[model samples]
Target: MWVRYLGFVILFGLPGALHAQPCGAPGLDGGYFVPLQETYSHEIEIIYACDSGRKPAVEGWWATSTCQNGVWSPEPQCIGEEDCLPPEIPNAKFNKKQNSWYNEGNTIRVTCDNGYELKNRDATAVCLNGTWTSVPVCEISNNTCGEPPQIPHAVIIGQKYQASFAADSKVRYKCEDGYSVEGAESKKSIFCISGSWSELPKCSRGTRQNTGHGSSVEVTTSAGSGTQTVGGGSGSSAGGTAGGHPTSTESGTQPGGGGRGSGDVVHGGPTITGSSTTSVSNDRNSKPAFIPVNECGVSPVIPNGVVVQTERMYLKYECNSYYTRVGPDTVVCTNDGRWSELPSCKEAFCVLDLAQYSGIGIRQTGKEYIKEGETKNVYCSYYDYVIFTCTQGRVTYTRCCEAYYHNYGGC
Candidate 1:
């Protein structure tokens, strides 16, 4: 008996086996553990499974809990179908295989409505940890345009009927009589490039006539008001010349001598005199404002890819794992305020197809998927075997055979 005690001590160590406490039932709800026992020793692991049509609240159908310090670590429990409901997405719906409630590890595919596309091409969501993965978003395609804006005092040249327009469609605007486009010599036009329209043109009063005396005098009248503006130097009054800047004083006097307003002016500078005040604005030192051109919007989005902005107008594209990038990776904002041709990502692996080869034996009947640079083994017979490798969706294989296998020409 003493020798037997020594063997027990050697196997389980000294004080831990004798002093360590055991754990009682884990008290799992909607599930049960295997190999039931009244108490479990420390560090003993038990497999857990849920009832029919149920799965562990965790990621997988089955789970394992360990007994530690007189308690179960995870305290396993099962989740019902109500835990996860079908994901709802705008402008999109799940395919026919969609279930009312998805179990853990189940996947669902979706299709977008007309004129809309999935944010991530061919993306699917999987149920995990009692929740669903990120669902694909539906967005309007970049090639369509909404209704064009209306221009004030101008009408569309053609029929004003359609609610929406296709990409690259141009709409011409004709100003009403007595008003022409502010700076456009030809007809005003705005094009619907991509998904937005170009800047709209403005219309204003046109053609002002000047008539005065031989002392370089000019007279003009306001549109609706009877106020008259007279400017010219009469041999030496320090008045503004017809085409030159004012040097001493400028005034705007109401016709028929109703009221007069006077203001000081800078030498060799343009001046503006209003009818109410006696002050004038000097614009000799003001610099011209600059406007930037070709401002692009947010960068284009790609499925299974990421973008890194290298500059204000340039970005670099990179594909996720198991995908191959096609076309240029770097794109720059063009002069038309649009991004260059965007790149695409293609799956870099091939699905296993044994239909082309004869006498090939596979464990499964349907197709098998694999990433690039991975290999799959095929059995042709007792003495024949073939190893296949996938690269960029193409599959190639090599055969190994003995003397008997070579003579039999495989299965």
Candidate 2:
């Protein structure tokens, strides 16, 4: 009876073990599968899909895989020529926000920078298969300024007259003989500011008085009954006696500050004194006080980054594709006339390499590419899982298999 029972148990259990063969999760490239599970029953089928701009190698945008005796039939794969990545155009920008990839037949609008125009017939580009068409080229604009405005009594210095001048060109002028620039504060050169010439400086007929060596001379006069004093010395001397009072005058010339005073004169009628002191304080020829500029020079160069905006006191930057900024994007001009601390561009995305963690089992749907700072959960066994965070180009987390084996005995 015992022998008969043993034979029955072997026959029944052996057949059961042979039919219990289940297939492991299928690995799909360039795509993903739906209803992911650790194991698939025999003859079970699951749907699979490809990313944008790709199609199943077999046919169509989607296909199916069937589990057969611990193996998947006709391994599923997504195949495509390629995808249209963001284009790099000098002095040009896209009209819409950029994405990682563009599907076939996708269209995007492009715009040129200031003072530049698109060289292409259209401003739009279309993605055909894996190539881009109608991509724009930026070129300097043709807009120009005609001959600089003619000054009444001045001529352009070091520049010949021309029919037209390019944008941002500069033309300086000098006053003709016996003529000087009018306003105390005026720019001597005209600039092409934003495709237009700046206002021209006026040339006055009379020349400005030149006070040599920053010095000036004064004149004084006196009326009747008024005692007059003329001198360059501190102590006064009697020039003559008038109305019983002695008039004093000093002989030598004494320079006071930047001005010099001549002797005094007597006139008739009521007392009338005229004293004029002309100093070279407001003279344009005098050397002005040195003032330090509170602005920065050229912005600092950043790796894998571009300056979006630069001004006297501020600078802003943007990173290129697949790179992330590690610090503040905007920097301020410091008191030392230099830019503040700059930022750096680091790897911004990572690719999940399942082969590196092959011992661990993945339970949830996984993405091929993970952005920096993004988190995903992966499984090691039926009861063990780990959450991984992507930093720069790496994904880091404690291994779920190590914890599962130590805590749960086995899967």
Candidate 3:
């Protein structure tokens, strides 16, 4: 009976009976592999685990790598959180500890050096994850000044007395009656620097010459205002004779026309042209000013290129790769204030002339053409093999056909 029982166990339980060894897909280190001991007869799913300070490098449908046979994909790793590089603030300097790198929770201090003051509410930066907060700016004020100094025996001419002067303020002075400086004295004036006045000249007693008695007097001024001015003098008064300062072929109307209300003088073309005398009709009429070159309309805009600069009379066009400029690179301003020659950028193409070999029964398949850096395979009945390539708008060919077939053996 014992022998029979042992045989039955060996035959059915050992080799064929008990659960068969598993060959199902394996699971990751931190994943939930259901029925850890499941066999081929059943399927199992792997669900990954999550932890603090780390996240799935991949997720959603990307959770699984394909599995074949019994092998599993590489385990998905939870990457560490990232940190950002140090932030840079313009016009301001940032301070950090030596050998210190920006990481999570680190702070940076910044401040301005030049008479510059901060424009932002905060000057410190803190690192969070991979981003930084807003930064501050250092700015300088160009129009702030203090009090103007008083000089003895002199008073500012045509100037209202303001307790303090701002930057770029000017004051003119003339000696009290009968008092004057030595020979050849130019006008006496002083400009306000940062907070004080620039160097000034003294007025000493001297002789005043009147070149009026026999000489004729003529006074004239130029139209428009700004630094570009024309000041004229009479025989006895102290201004110099004003005449020529060339005008541009196209004179611009000051902004808002006749320049009555606005102070902007918009001129086109070169600097000088026309009559320098005060012809600009103190006209106060609100008519639009005339510019010479309405003729030079809008500049040409290339599809994939740009005009880097257009300051002078002539303009240049810039193009990118795979494109060629068909005309002149520079266009000069014409007499009418228009561009003399306009250029265009065209797409470069590689050309092939199979017509030259038409007698050999070789023909292009269609009316289409190939662009630069392209190639086409040709089927030549008389010659077996030929290949052609287009590069930089130039056509090149290679001959692979044998010597036995054609009149032109190779190209």
| Model 2 misplacement above 4 A | 1-82, 96-98, 144-181, 186-411
Q: Scored by CA lDDT, what does every candidate get?
A: 0.59, 0.58, 0.47
By TM-score, highest first, what's the ranking?
1, 2, 3
Which residue pairs does candidate 2 place in steric collision?
none
Candidate 1, residue 353: the lDDT equals 68
Compared with the true structure, what per-residue lDDT tens digits does model 2 show for residues 9-127? 89887886567678899888778997899888988998999988576655456789888888887677675655465677887888543334565566778887755667833577776
Choose the strongest candidate by TM-score: 1
Give the count of colliding residue pairs in each prediction. 0, 0, 7
> How high is the lDDT of residue 130 in model 1?
59
Which of the predicted structures, 1 or 2, would earn the higher lDDT when compared with the native?
Answer: 1
Q: Give the higher-lDDT candidate: 2 or 3.
A: 2
Evaluate residue 82 in candidate 3 and report its C-alpha lDDT on the 0 to 100 scale.
43
Q: List the residue pairs that clash in candidate 1.
A: none
Clashing pairs in 3: 246-272, 246-273, 247-272, 247-273, 248-272, 248-273, 296-338
Q: Count clashing pairs, candidate 2.
A: 0
Report the lDDT of model 1 for residue 368.
70
Worst 10 residues of 3 by lDDT: 261-270
Query: Candidate 1 regions off by >4 Å?
Result: 1-139, 184-186, 210-411
